[model samples]
Target: MILEVATITLRSGNADEYVRVMPDAFPVLASTPGYIRHELHRGIERPDVFTLFVWWESVEAHNVNFRESDRFPRWRAVWGHLMEGAYVEHFAQVY
Candidate 1:
């Protein structure tokens, strides 16, 4: 499986709004092919920062299947406006 980790920074005071709209965006991601599960973590020291973890069957599932699909825009529409920037990376279990 592939783990996609995205560190997202939101516009000031938009954290609450971002969390509120997440449920609405989840469905778009859940419906994608090879999607396994996901989780959202808020920064303790930085309220405007969040980490999103998504599990996919393969790298292509995220890089191509999801990002390249029309669903990308649909997903973005839910909370894209709240985000200032993001850094995303993928990982594989070592053990």
Candidate 2:
């Protein structure tokens, strides 16, 4: 399995809007091939900071199946404007 971690920082006063709009993309993401699951976390001390943990069958599954598909743009269109900065990376279980 592959894990995609995305660290996101929201623009000032955009936290509430971000949270509201975030779940809107779940259906799109869930429909993606090879998309296993995902979790969204917010920093306690810094509410504007969030990290999205996504599980996929593989990196290609994430990229080709989701990011390369219409879902990617659908997702970005909803939240891109709210982001102050964001970064994404992939990971694997150590075992």
Candidate 3:
């Protein structure tokens, strides 16, 4: 399996709005092929920071299957504007 980790920073005072609108993007994400599950976590020390964890069957499931699909834009439209910046990376269990 592949694990996608996205560290996202929101614009000032946008954290509440971002969390409120997150559910609107779930359907779009869940419908994607190879999508397993996901989680969103807020940083305690930095209220404006969030971390998104997504599990997929493989890297291609996200990079190609999802990102290349029409759902990408739809998903982004949900909260993209709320983000000041984001960094994404994929990982696999070493053991």
Worst 10 residues of 3 by lDDT: 62-71
The Cα error of candidate 1 at residue 38, in Å, is: 0.3
What lDDT tens digits, residue by residue, belong to model 2 across residues 3-87? 9999999998898899999889788888999999999998899999999999999999999999999999998898899999999
Clashing pairs in 1: none
Per-candidate local distance difference test: 0.98, 0.93, 0.96
Residue 76's lDDT within candidate 2 is 88
What are the TM-scores, per candidate, against the unseen true structure? 0.98, 0.95, 0.97
RMSD of model 3 against the true structure: 0.7
In candidate 2, what residue range of length 10 has the lowest lDDT sum?
Answer: 21-30
Q: Note the clash tally of each candidate.
A: 0, 0, 0
lDDT of 1 by residue, 1-61 (tens): 9899999999999999999999999999999999999999999999999999999999999
Candidate 3, residues 1-95: lDDT per residue as tens digits?
Answer: 98999999999999999999999999999999999999999999999999999999999999998999999999999999999999999999898
Better of 2 and 3 by lDDT: 3
Q: Which of the two, 1 or 2, has more TM-score?
A: 1
Candidate RMSDs in order: 0.5, 0.9, 0.7
Off by over 4 Å in 3: none
The Cα RMSD in angstroms, rounded to one decimal, for candidate 2 relative to the true structure is 0.9
The TM-score of predicted model 3 comes to: 0.97
